[model samples]
Target: MTDQYAVLGNPVTHSRSPFIHACFARQQHQRMEYRAIEAPLDGFESCVSQFLQGDGKGVNVTVPFKEQAWRLAACRTPRAELAGAVNTLWRDESGQLWGDNTDGIGLVTDLTQNVQVKLEGARILMLGAGGAVRGVIQPLLDAGCSQLFIANRTAEKAQLLVEQFAPLLPEGVLLQGGGYTSVPSDGEFDLIINGTSASLSGDLPPVNPVIVGAHTLCYDMMYSARPTAFCQWAITHQAARAVDGLGMLVEQAAEAFLCWRGVRPDTAPVISLLRQSLA
Candidate 1:
């Protein structure tokens, strides 16, 4: 029998996980069935329980339910524990649930491997202190970035994020948080990542365009059928490259698949298919 997997979200019809996973299974010749599951907002736990009780092998959790999945898991990976969120779930032979957050590793891989952005000793500016940013911090720091600055619309929330991540700060690797205006103009950063929900609202953060230059890489954690607002803004401001989140999505899914099946699925072709579909 084919192993069963799915991605769960409240509003799940729009999810591309089913298509993405289908591509992975076909390419890897893995016998698996993947689907998108819509669970009621308040029924996330019960829905997951039901799935587990069936032939479910694993699940990809999204958005409003990530936190709840983190709480429901019997055990969690270090990254998931640090992120306070879970996006991947699996049940062991013992019927114990395991949670992990592959979002950070996915983003890092997309940036360094796909985009060829060098992270070692690079100054990074991240826009937003929410779950997305939180999920990616450790991987970014681990990639040997010299400094990680998080700027948010609400300065206090940004500051609190820095505090929460203080333990992960490596010696000589700085982590700072503040309002966008507080970002010093000492020099242009090598990489700038947008993790804010501003793109969802068709808005860019209130940051100075001067921060972007011809050599800066601008990345938005939002993907659209066309260029996202942040990507447009980055291009208008002369960023070296403006990338959306489609690659991150595919890479994260690959990581989740690896966690469940112990085989790394190739992601480049899947990303190409997604980009073409979007185009």
Candidate 2:
């Protein structure tokens, strides 16, 4: 029987997960089926329970449901616990729910592997202090970034996030957080990551253009067929490179696939194929 998987979210009609997973399965010659599931706003728990009770083997949780999924899973990976959210879930042979967050690894892979930007000893500037930002902080810090500055609309949230993760930082890895308005007025950073939802509203968060000099690499966690507001703004400021999060999405899905099937999917081909289709 074909193993079953799905991506669960409200307003899931626009999800490309089904298509992405199908491509992955085809490339790996795996007998599996994946679909998009629309969960009611407040009915996430019931929806997941019902799906698992049936033939569903695993799910990728998105948006508002990620935190809820984290709570529902019987066990969570270290990364998921740090993120305080679960983006991937699977049932083991013992029928126990396993949770993990691949967003951090996904972001790291896209930045270092796909974009060819070295994270080691790099100065990083991250936009936003929400769940998405929280998910990726640990991995980025682990990748040997010399310093990370998290900027958000609300200063307190950023400070709280930094404090939460500060204990985990290596001796020399600097992590600081504050409002975007508090961005240092000094030098440019090696990489700038936009983890904010500002792109969804077609708005670019207020950022210091001086922080994005010609050599800075700009990455937006939001992806679209066209350049997102953040990506466009990065370009206008003459960033060395501006990339959207499409590759991150695929890479994260690949991580989830590895966790479920114990096999890593080659993401480059899938990313290229999707880009072509979008074109």
Candidate 3:
């Protein structure tokens, strides 16, 4: 039988993982079956257990269930441990459940490879203090950015993130967090990433427009058929480039695919396919 895999979550009907993984498997000529499974909101643990007991090899957990998956895993990769969540899950020969988070690597890879936005030595401003932001912090720091300031409406929430990751801060790098109003005006930001759900609801993060310099790159972690509100804000401010997370979505799925199948698929074609479909 072909190896089986899936993505699990509540309201997973709209997930593009099946299509993304299908393209990857076909590209590498791997015999695998990937699909989406919508688990009941309160039955996440039971649902995942049922799948793994069957022919399921691994499954990607999303949204509300990621934290639940993290708790259920017998082992976790360091990234997943820091994230306090798990998006990818598998098992060892001993049947011990293992979890890892590919979100940060996904975002970093997309920005560096697909978007060609340099991360090394770059000054980055990230807007958000939620789980979505937490999953990507270590990887962003690991990318060797010179400075990363995380801003949120609740200043204390952002500061908590700063404290949590302080021990892992790289040499010659500065990491800080505060309210949006606390964003520095001393220098232009090399990159601004909107990790907030503001763009999903068509709202821009409350930050000054002066942060966008001539060469600044603005990226929204949310993607839509049209420009995200943050992307529109970037364009209106004359930022050098405005990008969405579609590439990150594809790249992350590719990372999970590699974990399951041990082969990395080319992401460029999958990203192009998703963009065209979104348009």
Residue-wise lDDT of candidate 1 within 1-279, one digit each (tens)?
A: 678998999888889999999999999889999999999998999999888788889999997899999999999999999988999999988989999999999999999889989999999999999888889988899999999999999999899999988886888999999999998678888889999999888878988888788899999888989999999999998999999999999999999989988898989999999889877
lDDT of 1: 0.91
Regions of candidate 1 where Cα sits further than 4 Å from its true position: none
Better of 1 and 3 by lDDT: 3
Q: How well is each residue in 1-279 modelled by candidate 3, as lDDT tens digits? A: 888899998899989999999999999999999999999999998888888898899999998898899999999999999999899999889999999999999999999998998899999999999999999999999999999999998899999999999998999999999999999988889999999987776667889998899999999898888988899999999999999999999989998998888999999998888889877
Deviation from native of the Cα of residue 121 in model 1, angstroms: 0.7
TM-score of 1: 0.98
Sliding window of 10 residues with minimal summed lDDT for model 2:
199-208
Candidate 3: where is the Cα deviation over 4 Å? none
TM-score on alpha carbons, each prediction:
0.98, 0.98, 0.98
